[model samples]
Target: MIKHAALVSFLMHLDYFDAGNMDSFVDDLTVIPAGRGTDAAGQIVVCEMEYTGVYGIADYPHVQYPVQRLLAQISAWLLDHDTDRTTPFDFSVNVETNPRDDSKADLEIRIPFREAVTASADAGGELALAGEHYDVNA
Candidate 1:
């Protein structure tokens, strides 16, 4: 979650936004190759997001998200509003799959969308989760 904003900003600066017939930064976007780096808490929500539009894949780019200092704000907003945000999100191309334990998520998303996706599930069953919910308490 913390790296989300930074990643987004970087992508944007690199021209990662869709604008009519303009060139898209990424060919496609989905949730098959990312969504890792989440907390061990129950309740994990995986939202399929993306940033399109870019001139071309640059040779190199510099970016920052200030995860340490800004993560709290993002987390606070989620917690304050009771939103599920256990996974560290970022705009990506193709599809990616994120695991619940965060031990290892197959970072092999080169396609659009994916199967066997993990979702946000709450501990103590207080929050009912869908799909393959990863139990942080476990």
Candidate 2:
């Protein structure tokens, strides 16, 4: 499982937004298993995971440039930190204005990654599984 607090901290470290703004800007942060597939050798199960959240920003004049820059920065950060080269990294973003505050909008971001896991089971017995969870980009 990905820790929301840790992700928020990572974003703060990027300096795009300040600590005080975190509570207002970031929400519903989570990492979930999206799908699973076996590797070429069939020795490991590759699980596709998605890290997603809604980032709130002030909607104002000339806001497009900043939003674009923010997206680029996030993409770079993800590529630099959590990529394995063999697996493709994918991300998507959607913007929507807040109903309560037209001046505010949210950037819904989704980043996907692959994780390897080992699974085992015995007849009429319990199933045992183990996996390593990657941080941030993973």
Candidate 3:
């Protein structure tokens, strides 16, 4: 199964605060439908929501609402789909608050996944799981 521990480990290498890397990071780690296609396999859904003009914590609902909705969608998708649990899936978000403007913040959501493959070794020879040549003579 896709363990929480493995997901945490994958997240440790990410630097969400780096704007230059944001595009690549999001692109590489998003799993969503593409080009009017229904197949979500090998794709990630990325959502970025921004909130502005808030003056206090009490006014944070504007930001919270969209985030909550996106999270719900992601949660629902994960639950509804019968995916290969052993393959790693990334369901994570990065929230950034403006340093100069406390009222401004953004939420970045990513759900990276891979298409499941169900096959055993082909006839005549076996496939090497690690891409190394097998010692057939041995």
TM-scores of the candidates are 0.21, 0.44, 0.29
Please rank every candidate by TM-score, starting with the best.
2, 3, 1
lDDT of 2 by residue, 28-92 (tens): 43434433434433223434333344544443222433556767776666566555434333444
Model 1: per-residue lDDT, tens digit, 49-75?
432322222221112322232335433
For residue 64, give model 2's deviation from the true position in Å: 11
Worst ten in a row by lDDT for model 2: 128-137
Among the numbered candidates, top lDDT falls to 2
TM-score of 2: 0.44
lDDT (tens digit, per residue) of candidate 3 on 20-123: 32232223433332222124432222222221111111122333244455346435544555253343244333444332334434444444444322223323
Top candidate (TM-score): 2
In candidate 2, which residue pairs get closer than 3 Å at backbone N, Cα or C atoms, i.e. clash? none
Off by over 4 Å in 1: 1-24, 33-38, 45-128, 131-138
